[model samples]
Target chain A: MAEPVLSIRDLRKSFGALKATDGVSLDLRPGEIHALIGPNGAGKTTLIHQIAGGITPDSGEVVFLGEDIGALGVAARARRGLGRSFQISSLAPEFSALRNVMLAVQSRQGSSFRFFRPVMKDRSLTEPAMAMLERTGLAARANVPAAELSHGERRQLEIAIALALGPRAFLLDEPMAGMGPEGSRALTAFLDGLRHEAPILLVEHDMDAVFALADRISVLVYGRVIATGTVDEVRGDAEVRRAYLGERP
Target chain B: MSRERAINLLLAGLLLSVPLAALALGELFYITLATRMAILALAAVGLNFALGLGGLVSFGHAAFFGIGGYVAGIFSSHAFNQTPLFSWPFEFFGSDQMPAIWLAAMLISALIALPIGAISLRTAGVYFIMITLAFAQMIYYFAISWPAYGGEDGLSIVVRNGFPGVNTAVPLIFFLVCYVLLLAALALFALVRDSRFGAALQAGRQNETRLAAVGIAPFRIRLAAFTISAAITGLAGALLADLNRFVSPSMLSWQMSGELIVLIILGGTGRLFGPVAGAMLFVLFEFVLGGLTERWQFFLGLILLGVVLFARGGLIGVLAGKARHG
Candidate 1:
């Protein structure tokens, strides 16, 4: 088997008294969709944050492609092909959607030091940025500022920004958190299409979309992974059902 | 054209034509005034790096600015007097070259900015502003109390610092030197704004957490920007000293720092020519208003407060609207 693109071994983190991510272990292989599903405050975001190197794991390790990346910073991790989308939209709202993605592509390219000619005229940068946007279904919204994009469109733009980074893997935190049915369907399709390109560790709550898209589902409860299995296995496991699935009652 | 694009083009055109018109009309004073605008704008451009791009509202850039001026002033004074500059047992020191003085000023400013940024970046928002202000005050007081080069009265250069093949005494020639440096700094600002490093810097301002998640350290990016910021402003300081042939503690005061911030805001924070437009407008206001009323600053304060509260985007924002930052 090929080496898993990302490997987490007994990762742990705490915020004051709260154990945000407690001994969470997971592995993500290339070209797979792994959903981290948990209720609100389930430590799902914290777990992904640790893996993305946003927060340091207090114990254990988050090793990506054989390197202990938990200790590295955000840009360094991004430079190494790990791209992520924020739960909250973190784009430069004032900049156009094209410029937003261009900034990402600009970051990926070695030099942005060419100053005499305006970057806007750099077809080398803008062409690829537009192509990435087209791939994410945001080609029509390319000229609009990200602030002007709809919530769903902005979310797509976020994914587009990540894709511009040319990541081998993606950490998408709640891509469908605030979407309507149409928005959710659109995002689901986008994620489904993305899985063929690179591994995505999806943190989501919508079980219907989660079951429909995830190759594997990990049920997390109170910072610990209670169950990890095929969709049917998680749906049938009494412990997972009792801890999360059955808890709806 | 879009309203923003139209206004930017108009403003750039006007600024580009000002010196040419001044020369054509034989308004020699306008040349000096335009030079002042370019130098002050250059300093504001430096502050914009920290303020506009990095979201660091540094209120201490004047300290760097004045330090740059003093380096030029001190060296030129020693050369004019033909006196030994605190001569050590071995090293002789009386070079009054502008490049050498600017280099010294940049090094000093960067050194000062490193420690100041280290401490100020620890806090966010209002605290950052106050800490930077306090550090500038520390330097201001140091300049006031130290009796080395004229104490509170300040040092005067009898002759302007030398430049290769340039008549440093002629107002038009001097204005051209400042103009060229202004363009160079503008080019540098444009370069930094578009670079991968520039993206990281802007990201650090917008979402430090997200930036860190991508594997860049926010503290390091901010520190580098702050240092470069001081260095650029320091370059402006060197020029400003040459313009007046004097250096004073007033240049390092908090008021000067506040004026730098005002220039950025008045022009448009984050806009490329915002500082240039702002500097031009600010000098024009001072010249026109000072001629109109002795209490021009009080009116300037009233106008500034109005701009901050109502204009939101300042002159650049008012004229150009929102700019596209890459």
Candidate 2:
């Protein structure tokens, strides 16, 4: 197998008496969708936050691109090619979809300190942004503000923004939370293709998408990974079935 | 082609024409009033960069205004007294030169703003507002207690600061100088508004988390904006001190800071010519209404209330329709 692009090493986080994430470990290899699924309040989001540099773990290491990125900030980690999306759709609501992607493109280009030239006129930012929007099939709504775009469109816009960062690894937290059946199918297909460009650590509740997409599965329970294996192996595991996939499996 | 652009041009043209006309009609006092409008407008323009564009409600901008005023006052007074300001720093003598004082004012104000913004920007919302207000009050009291510059009595220059190739002491020429500088400041604000830096700053204002996800630290962007805003406000302060021939704690007072915010709100927050429009209307109210009754501020209060309740976007918004970005 290929060397893991992202490795989570015994990450632990606590809030006073309760441990949010207790010694969780996982690895995401290149060109693979590693699904992390759990029930409500199982600390899936907390683990994702620690990996994406949003929350500091009490003890652990997040290694990305062969380097320990535990001490880096959200922006620093992102600049170092760790791209992520929030579980909730996070966007600059007032900005157009194209401008939203363009901002990411600008960051990728470096030095936002340029104060004279208008950003809209700069083809370097606009062309790549448009291409990303086109890739996500959001080219028609490029001029609409993110606030005005439909919920699924905003989700696509977020992915376009993440794509413009040219990330080496993707930390996608619930990318299909609000999508309709059709939207989910389209996004599932898109994400299937996206795995080849950058390995995805997907935190999802949608089992259909997860079952169809994940090559490897990690079932999280009470801030701990109870099982990690191929989809069939995890499905047949008695502990995972009892703790999570009960009756449905 | 845009309604806002037309309104901006009209506002700029009116500012220039009125002062020129005042000189023609031998109403030299009106030229002084126009100069006040220009200087105050310049100060508000600076605040708008941080407040309107960056969404930073800085209640302590008067600190920079007073710093600029004090820099001008100290420089000119030392020159008038034939005394060096300091000896250890290569025996630095004071300068009565306008360009030199303006440069010093911008540099000093930016320096002060950098540390203030760096510390204050760590917090957000009400805490940010209160911290800024506290910093301004500290500077205000310091000016009142410090005696070298005449304490509360304030420092007065013997003559207006000198500008090469012109008589700055003449009311019309001085007003023209201020008007030109105001125009330059407006151009700079527009450039920043449309640039790449502005995109990140505005994005930061709207959603800081998203800005970080995009790989830009919102703190550094806001700090740069705050420092630049202070530099422009400081330039206006130097001009104000020169115009009044005085520099007092009044320049650093919290009231001065509040007035700057009020001007931006009254004209149109984030609009290019909002400060100019607000200053013109404010001074006009003082002139026209003050002559009729001593309680003129009561009417200003009524206008402010009306703008807040009915026209939330202020005068320019009413004239230009909704803002392109807002």
Best by lDDT: 2
- Model 1 lDDT tens row, B1-326: 66765765676567557777888999878878888998999899899999988989998889999988888888788778778887678555666888888888889888998999999998889999999999999988998898988889999888888888888888878887887788788778887887666776776777676455444567877888898999999989999999998999999999999999999888888877888878988999999999999999998899888988998788878876666664
Report iRMS values in order. Answer: 3.5, 1.7
Model 2 segments beyond 4 Å from truth? none
- Output the TM-score of candidate 2: 0.97
**lDDT of the structure predicted as candidate 1:** 0.84
Report, in order, each candidate's fnat. 0.37, 0.80
lDDT of 1 at A83: 86
Model 1 misplacement above 4 A: A111-117, A247-249, B1-34, B86-90, B118-123, B194-200, B209-221, B291-294
* Cα error, candidate 2, residue B191 (Å): 0.9
DockQ agreement of candidate 1 with the native complex: 0.33
